[model samples]
Target: MSQVVDDSRGGAGPFSRFEFLVAGRYLRARRKDAFISVIAALTLTGIAIGVATLIVVMSVMNGFRDELLSKILGLNGHFSAYPLEERLTDYKETVGAIEGVPGVRFAVPFVEGQALASGLTESTGVSARGIEFASVQKLDLLYKSAVMGSWDGWDEGNGVAIGSRLANRLGVSAGDIVTLVNPNGTLTPFGRTPQIRSYPVSVVFNLGMVEFDSFYLYMSMQAAQDYFKAYDDVLVEGAEPPDVLATDEEIDAAYQRVYRANAIEIFIDDPDDIATMRTRIQSQVTRPMTMTDWQQRNETFFSALQVERVVMFTILSMIILVAAFNIISSLVMLVKDKGRDIAVLRTMGATRGSIMRIFSMTGTAIGVAGTLIGLGLGLLIAANAETLRAFISNTLGVTLFPPEVFFLSTLPSKVNAGEVGLVVALSLSLSFLATLYPAWRAAQYEPVEALRYE
Candidate 1:
């Protein structure tokens, strides 16, 4: 150990080289003080572990949220437009006007409703949608990634596309026939009759999201109108039996009132400006319209993810707090162990502030060293998180995450430098604070009192 008093004899500056050297010497415990060294080591280790864990966890959460946004928003429209009641009769003209609106990327007529899908071997509930294939094909998930299907033969009159998960459940494939039962069928003299239509499966797509892939079906707008009985909302459910048998003129008039499109799905130029786009386009159309953004539809789910991240960070920070307490304990014991030496220093003209500075530096040195080590370890683990997972799965024969359930094929991490800086400052601040009580206690010693005990 470097001898501070011997090497820096009569140093002029207060709390200068002599203080730092003595502080360094005190940190390396003597043989009899091995137990104090262990506690000091534990304090450093605890702080290190806490800081590293927090960094890795925050990065993973950020990556997870980003991944979810990309996958979910890739398939769904940014905003939806619809009338208050009856379907838009002039939807084709409306869609054209919407496309011209500022910030609007693409607009298309959409028909969607519930139906009972019956396959060769199974039957399930589905949200069948009528779509303009050209506009739908522009989506990245539908064309570039996440989905596996061809646009070929998809609007070939009455042909429909099914999701991969749904196809697997129904035991149906391309070119196979699937029947859809529409409960909102035509009413008859006896009673309301359900309508059924059989269509060929044109393709199978995978949306990657389990909820979407397992429950959504798509077909041409014409097929949806025919199969779903989509028409003008001109019929009163409880009218007085129509007073007579409906004639061709009355039927033609009512059929004309039926609009082919129930809603308009729109893609905005910038998804982030959805609210601004909504305001800009709301006045363009005279019809009573309701507009909803993707965020509005899924606020609860995303909010929960954000809340979990905050809670995890708060909980992990407590670990560092516990480590600070350990530092306090270690420093207090060091002060007690060096009471006689402290008196010697005081007798040799050391001021109370100088004594305090020496102990403070000792405690702070432990903190700085631990924080650096922890920072390096944390970043290493975060960068190699996926590799670690793969290694565990392969070497230990334990599967970490199943892609189907988790909606992600690999672990992701995105460290924010600002957050890391904040953590370092916090850890160092806490370490400095922990030294105050012990350092102050050391400076309070009276040379005569300490020497009498010695």
Candidate 2:
């Protein structure tokens, strides 16, 4: 009895060696208490699954948001300036002034309109953008995305660039001809007549975004202006026709005199500094123009994505909460099954706090182990997310993340350390809290009554 008491006490301390020893014994349960062990295993598995799921889901959501933002903002500038009252006839000077502003990267002038494009296979509606060759070269995203053909003589020839998807849909490639029909065409005595024209596909670009790749086409600034007849009224009123035998410089000067841009698209160094950048640009341009930022244009779409992410996090968190409840139930059953052991330890000079500490250790060990395992599993899965996605997609003969619906061509994952830490903290906190009730119940066990039944 003296040795048993000495062993159980293991010196006068809060969490003595004896407490950990007994907790370990209870964790490695005997055959009679195998059912309790099973519950504990299930509880651990539950916590592990919950943490892993949360990490994977959060990473995917982050990746989705980042990819979409990059693709969208990469194609569209940070903001654009549209004329309020008059045609942007002097857009070149305006662009120069705007580009001189601090934090401004570059400004481009382009004409955008809708047209029906007819290919060999079928006809589809296209968003046509007429941009200068120099400006097109400055658009890093579009310029670098060219997969077929070259932009060598982009402005010299009557050719247009189309997205890779659009080219594929039209069953046309670079060097193939695609016809465009404009509903708002030249004005005639009868009425405004639709204009039909054809141009060879100069370049095929893959923006890696479904919407842009499937619908957008680009032509030269001169071609766009001529096709759209932009600023025709202003030109007809302001400038006279050049002489037939005019010099090259004289003719070029006359062209510039009449040329006008629909809007000036401004790219800034930092897109997040929209308010300050807008103020600076507006002040520098001194033109009566309405400014619009990327954030303003994409507010609704991004807002919906943010809301969906929050809701998904909340829903997935319930899995962890349910696992926490399982921990409580499993510990309660373990404490009940170990009633005789608790009584024996109490009679052998064990304090209530010692008994509580032992059980708390038992439950918390499960939590810590589960959390660590989940952290490893989640990181591994996230790191090889794309590879796994492809493997699974091939095996199942189904697309996991279709580019048409998701806007990205492949599965993407970005694991944020802060978010992973939060998940770990939440899991550990829930696990610790769950142990309190069962530990308290064990601490309250009356040695006399418990032993009398035994």
Candidate 3:
């Protein structure tokens, strides 16, 4: 039996350990065939490129998802409650009750409708949202997000907020009066009719998203109620009719009478909590079909992102798998070339297990080194993807992702540590697994036969 020495702690004679010598020699020895070194370098580079590309792509996807979610949640409420029927009375008391719910950040009553805005030169379809001017300011960042004019202007008679693109389409500016026509108009005894109203542009907002910027508008609740002819419908049973324009005392008494049945809308600040609240609210509200959260409203877009992330990760992982094959071939060649040395070592009291460990260690070294290098490269690229993209754009004289083609103008990356760790672990595991056959072959060599060939 060969006596194994514990040279790992410097307590043994010469050639006392198996793995350290084999790995060090294999890495440092000058090879007669430079192709081996070249192949190894290529394998390392391939792994680095693959890992870096995967990190950059995943990070960008995550960034896009985050940006889109922010835009949606910022502009829209976390959750919205409306009447299951067509109308809600006593909206003020409902708002107060919803505001008391835990995690509720703000609650407001809103009315919205679709209308067409027309100027002298052009006309466009737009969605008009009606909100209390003071409540709207507190509930949303709309005031801060506005590029021009004031949200308060909507309080002034017949004032409206238009999107930047809508403004451009209609060829109008703030303070310019545009005619709004409701195509879904009430039927008159005389003929089919359209309700036409003129509103002066109060504010113009640009959210940096073309979809919203082209379609959204804001006006006061009073204006929207009048426009939609819904004021009478939203008032209490004994309240003065909308056409009468109730005084403050009458409005307060009317609100108290109908507050119990009014449907309330709640907005929360945290998006992750939205799902839980949505489910709870859906179950809690008597009219379950009427409430909705922003996530439910934008499920399609969010689902697409999840699908994209999985597909991209699966596809990029193939690059590392291909590189693993190179490692297998390189180790196989090494095992064949060292057959004679392996036999001599066996004769000199080296166990089959030791020989196995030697080759296994060599392969492990290659994999570990490659994995570390790849991780560094990937993280570096993730940290500087924007700068690299900008530099490339400047050098190539072409934008890699133009805002017209891509929603975002610049490359965005966010490296998740867990994601990076998983990638490195996967790459290293593949490389180690690929070395198994070659290492096993080295351990199975017949000593006498291998020496005879030498």
Tell me, by TM-score, which candidate is best. 2
Off by over 4 Å in 2: 1-14, 233-257
Lowest summed lDDT window (length 10), candidate 3: 256-265
- lDDT, model 2: 0.89
**Residue-wise lDDT of candidate 1 within 203-240, one digit each (tens)?**
78875667667888888887887777676556544443
Which residue segments of model 3 deviate by more than 4 Å? 1-18, 29-31, 119-121, 139-141, 152-154, 171-178, 185-189, 233-265, 269-289, 386-411
Q: Write the candidate numbers in order of decreasing lDDT.
A: 2, 1, 3
Look at candidate 1 and give me any clashing residue pairs: 231-258, 232-258
**TM of each candidate vs. truth:** 0.81, 0.91, 0.81
Clashes of 3: 0
- Comparing 2 with 3 on TM-score, the higher-scoring candidate is 2
lDDT of each: 0.82, 0.89, 0.74
lDDT of 3 by residue, 1-454 (tens): 2443233223254333555776678766465746766777777777777777777788888777777777677767777787765456657755765666667787777777899889767988888878887766775556676787777656666788887877888988888888999966677897768989998888888776666777888888788877766555245656655346768776666653312223345778577787777665555444334677777888897898899899999999999888888888888888887888888878766667667777777776777787788788877887888899899999999888776555654566788878888888898888888888888999999899998856
Task: Name the regions of candidate 1 deviating beyond 4 angstroms.
Answer: 1-15, 119-121, 157-159, 173-177, 232-259, 269-275, 384-412
As for lDDT, the candidate ahead, 1 or 3, is 1
Candidate 1 TM-score over all chains jointly: 0.81
